[model samples]
Target: MESETYRGYNVWGHAILQQEAILAPERFAASGTITRNNKLVEASGVLGLFNAEAEAEQAGLAWALAWIDSHG
Candidate 1:
């Protein structure tokens, strides 16, 4: 799990290890998880798909941070 810290929460990125063949073939899916005080607060469901893992991580981090900003 790759992660970033934002507003006292740990925003983590999850990579798709096993992709289903029926989904979009050109993109890879990723999710985000938010942890605060060593506890899980939120988990984003399939936030994005991208051509590269780095891209997915970037997008996931952005989404998680935005969620924190809006909901925190």
Candidate 2:
């Protein structure tokens, strides 16, 4: 079997994800805006002491911006 990964998530269980993207062509396009939980997203992109709530929120926006830099 060919091995590949997308967004760090294994594609094996991603058939549903593929289906979702296919169903919503716009959402699957190269660039699109989508909403997510502030708590979950806040930790990824911001720089600060870990576990800091306010910092996490800022980091999340940074995280998303970083993602855009590469994905765009």
Best by TM-score: 1
Q: TM-scores of all models? A: 0.79, 0.31
Which ranges of candidate 1 are over 4 A from the true structure? 18-26
- Please give, for residues 11-69, the per-residue lDDT of candidate 1 as tens digits: 98866754567684556578889999999999889976788777787777888898999
Residue 55, model 2, lDDT: 39
The C-alpha stretches of model 2 lying farther than 4 A from their native spots are: 1-51
Model 2 lDDT per residue over 2-69, tens place: 11233432211101111255454421111112234322221131133333333333343444455545
lDDT of 2: 0.30
Clashes of each: 0, 3
lDDT of 2 at 32: 16
